[model samples]
Target chain A: MGGPRRLLLISNSTLHGGGYLGHCQQHIQKFLGQNVKRVLFIPYALHDRDAYARTARAKFESLGYGLDSIHEFCDPVEAVRKSEAIFIGGGNTFRLLKALYDNSLIHEIRKRVLEDGIPYMGSSAGTNVATISINTTNDMPIVYPPSLKALGLVPFNINPHYLDPDIKRTHMGETREERIRQYHEEPNTPPVLGLREGTMLLVEGDKATLQGVTGARLFLRGKKPTEHEPGTDFSFLLNDSNASNL
Target chain B: MGGPRRLLLISNSTLHGGGYLGHCQQHIQKFLGQNVKRVLFIPYALHDRDAYARTARAKFESLGYGLDSIHEFCDPVEAVRKSEAIFIGGGNTFRLLKALYDNSLIHEIRKRVLEDGIPYMGSSAGTNVATISINTTNDMPIVYPPSLKALGLVPFNINPHYLDPDIKRTHMGETREERIRQYHEEPNTPPVLGLREGTMLLVEGDKATLQGVTGARLFLRGKKPTEHEPGTDFSFLLNDSNASNL
Candidate 1:
């Protein structure tokens, strides 16, 4: 069995714009567990190479880091090999997933991170890829591709930008909590994560801790909402708290 | 324009069981508001009258109200002419909408409520009738009828059980928000009300007030989520908001 190591995932961070790279930096610093050395950047989120480079550079500088310290790659396999820690930035998650599947990068990311024990990081769509299925993605599923698999870094589904229940008016639909509650009613479903902005899950060597704020809500089937905080053992995901897959 | 008055609309309050006398309740309440009294109950939601009456009686008792206050009639025109507040109760919205159109009760209800300045309230299927279109409804848009037009009490679309966004998780085709968002993006479309449970919209003299703890989430073009609070002068629909005839 492979062992757990440092990792990060993103669903989306640019709420209105400008926070993408800063969010990435914060995640990188958190996941590297030290100064990040030799990181690989994927240019899949941008249409133009120059634009991607510019955006990447701006993000790196804002983080007090340099673009040259990181390797930019178009090919997934090559990028996966040279990286000590992999960081996926947020854009259109469906587009990102499509590119990863099209380039056959899913296997490389999974093998390197899950099998090779390389540190992994993702934001927004990047965070979305850490799950087994991309169904929980909040992005429009308009860009549906044949492959639905992801890096399988996390077992729970992620819902970024989770809004709370607003009680004051009449609507003709089910609430988000109600929807998840309905999901839980279905037999044998995975636990769903309603991660508000700026929350991260940290897993390293049989110990998984929620790094951000406590009071994050977990919606389980047939039960009231449960609260999870930092250092709460997520080993429930991998069986025993001490059982490392690596 | 007719002045506002009290109205009660219901979808379903008895949980899984649909009310049979729901349509009759609409006619009776409408007639009562208009001073038309006494009618008979028809079990559309239930195959048997005894079951429907039993449930209806229980509902009335729970509310400390009595069915003896008004006559229950399944007949449309006979019920419409005598009522002031038209109330439709909880049952299958599709079935209720179908029955309303099948018997041409749509025109009569509109004529009495809109033209005559009568109050109108509905629940479950009754609530479904207030919207101009039921296309956004979470329930299956099953129809034996060729066209789908609700009573059009409200001007916009209704998406009952409006769920909050979670990352892509389930294979429920598309989430409610995605569906409504796509509907709006379809070029010259109506607005949608994503109403959670325990919420209602109160209409008084040229104004619609959102009621209950969970207010409606408005999905508009080029805007973040906006809350529609109770007692705020508003429309339960998009068409009514702009007063644009579609």
Candidate 2:
């Protein structure tokens, strides 16, 4: 067994014309399973912490699962320990990493999700934290997190809401392709999984499958991005070879 | 006079159809003046060290100024100390900051520009480093720098190549405006100056004026984004009062 590396890494929480978490409700419910009655939500990415928590709680409650935001708990580390399922929603990645590091919940959450076998699900910035580091995130570094180190639930780094290069665009802003190419410059940086919006990766121990109709992009240094079709087996991405792939 | 805090902070290096440093070459030449004959170029923002320097040298040479890239120097700190004028070209802010810190040139460069009054010109990521921090940069954090602390040449932070929110765009990613708003959520984070492409800011002493044809957006927390027309005074952005103004 590849240990309990269960993950529901979503590219975005909300899609075009969909309510918050609307598009992925069934996938989320199915992923959590009937056994996990409660989930600890991490809503630190947004400014309105309470409102973000409430929104997630509403969705979880409707699915017959309870969601309590870590912000409400007296001790966040303790909350991670007791959480049967961890659901991290999308927002600013820097803010989320800042909160995670500030509360010293990084190790506790990593242990809970990767070792104890608690089902871990994340969207956007949430999915960003599940990877090796927050390096590939598109969010502005609004706040300084102590470190970019994040829970290494996945072997490779993830770029959620991954966008393709729009050749027609005249904007000088670096395209998604160029940005990831720059990421490859860093020595020892991991390969990136470009999870497009409406696309999600479902991990059941050793295997990770692209769950949505849309395909995801995989980026390796010095190589053109290769598209991974839905249902493509990405188990090789988690192997020990990845830690040294760079 | 605190020497001459002459700053030519450009929003972007190039426009759509323009050549490298196109659309602003005349402004750069005018800003540098006849006295400054040479410039020390910091091309750390680009992944290719030598190629970036060569390209920049080509442009500076055509402009009748000799450009010496810091990468070639034996002691980078010495190079900064001896630079007649400094030109920081733009690419990746994280990479730029990382190189600066790794070489221990952050303080030296800051002193050369802010205190020594070296004529400092920068574009895109280059302008980002001159701000309070590189927190608002659009580049991916491919590598972790020791800290986000950058040259506080200006009191406010800068968001270079700033694009406005497009209401018609259905992408779930946070718009430029929304991202800056999220930056405001940080308690001590400085106000961000959203500099649109093709525009630049000219700072002389404590006074700063928005240059180029387009106006710039000023984002102060709890207040609507107010536009400052080109040639309007922006000295207030550098005041001690600015900290509390937000």
Candidate 3:
């Protein structure tokens, strides 16, 4: 019974933390429990890990943790293997993905979190990795390079930082809708999770609930984007009773 | 002044034979003299237009042109536009450009065809009008929707086949070397030429040369592809004098 539902996802603490910090902290506490033991931070690529460590340290401290509370590591694999709950902070998703692929940590993380029942939390790229494909990650493709294959943890895709169409004027890339459309074209592609900022998909047992701000969108092909408010549970999507390991 | 420069480009027509029968005979003969009127073909994109057309109509005949008969779309646009002869054969340069863009075409075609006083030719989407970009001839972006801009002819874009890539994988999607690379990066794009079948880039000055055979490669970036022969004229690259437009 405690097999496939041991996940502890935390939003990236340093990603423009203002109002979103409180929301993420609350969610983290809710998932990891108040008797939190050990938390590890992984900063694999950036030349300066102190900045990331400091930001994470501050957020964790404000959430009722010690000053020297969280342990940080440049080696994600080692940190992921030893921790009770692993929190991956977001900076550059490409950098994070590269680090994961480079150190061969994805297989380990998948095995431990999904197969062995460890609490795993992610944000931004971290959250995106929860899905089967990186097709929905809201990052420019050529900014790094294209890696068609991703860590297929969940059956659906994830679009972090999902914004409305008007936001297209600001970014010089394909809209979230356009990219998702491309994904759907691939024969038998998965569903997509368009998670706006502050939105999280909480999976416990076999039930997955939508948490945080309202007005988030879930985009799927041959169907209109169904809008949902906060407290709206998407347990139907995670109906493992009939789920196939396809 | 009488025997000035002109161009005649065909999208895809096989000298050896095998594939779709696009506008080859009438267009080729329209531009080339009797001696130079044989078809030019790029076998890469599956050159077979001539054979198909000839066999289909029964009144058709083989042109039997080789690499010498066909030029790589990598020559100076001016030289291509002003040549005593010109003929662009087809195959997928997007397939061809796996070897094409590295040698560079985005810049050369613009100079030769746009800046110089030479006639230009194209067929299918080969009559490129995808100016803001240069690669959507075969691929259609929207469905009876937005008015997509292209390379502005005389400052516009061309969309040959105007609606081909969308329907067939025989032609890849609109992600050609130059188009995909430039689409998400550049702003304030251009107009285009959506040259469908039986269409051509006709500049009837005093003399017209036939280039592009089998089928034409679309120019979505700004201008047409620079014509070249792998070993003789160029080594899949244009000299500095030619590669200045992109």
Look at candidate 2 and tell me the lDDT of residue B92.
92
Compared with the real two-chain complex, what DockQ does model 2 have? Answer: 0.88
User: Where is model 2 chain A poorest over a 10-residue stretch in terms of lDDT?
Assistant: A237-246
- Cα lDDT tens digits, model 1, A93-141, are 5567877878777878878887878877676667777876565555533
Per-prediction RMSD in angstroms?
Answer: 11.5, 1.6, 14.0
Over A69-165, each residue of candidate 2 has an lDDT whose tens digit, in order, gives 8999999999998888899989999999988999998999888877888899999999999998999999999888988888889888899998888
What TM-score fits each model?
0.50, 0.97, 0.50
Task: Write down the worst ten-residue block by lDDT for model 2 chain B.
Answer: B237-246
Best-fitting candidate, scored by lDDT = 2
Per-model chain B TM-scores are 0.73, 0.97, 0.42
* Predicted candidate 3 versus true structure: per-residue lDDT over A60-174, tens digit per residue: 7777754331334455566666666666665445456656677787787777677766666777767766666565554322223234345656666667766566542322223
Worst-scoring 10-residue span by lDDT in model 1 chain B: B38-47
lDDT of each: 0.56, 0.88, 0.46
By lDDT, the better pick of 1 and 2 is 2
Model 2, runs deviating above 4 Å: A1-3
In model 1, the number of clashes is: 73
User: B1-246 in candidate 1: lDDT tens per residue?
Assistant: 455444444333432222433323433343245343322222342224366556665654443334421224555566666664455554444455666676667777777767777766565555666777555555421223334566776667656555666564422224567666655544445666666555566665455666655567877644465777645556434235473433
Classified by CAPRI criteria, candidate 2 counts as: high
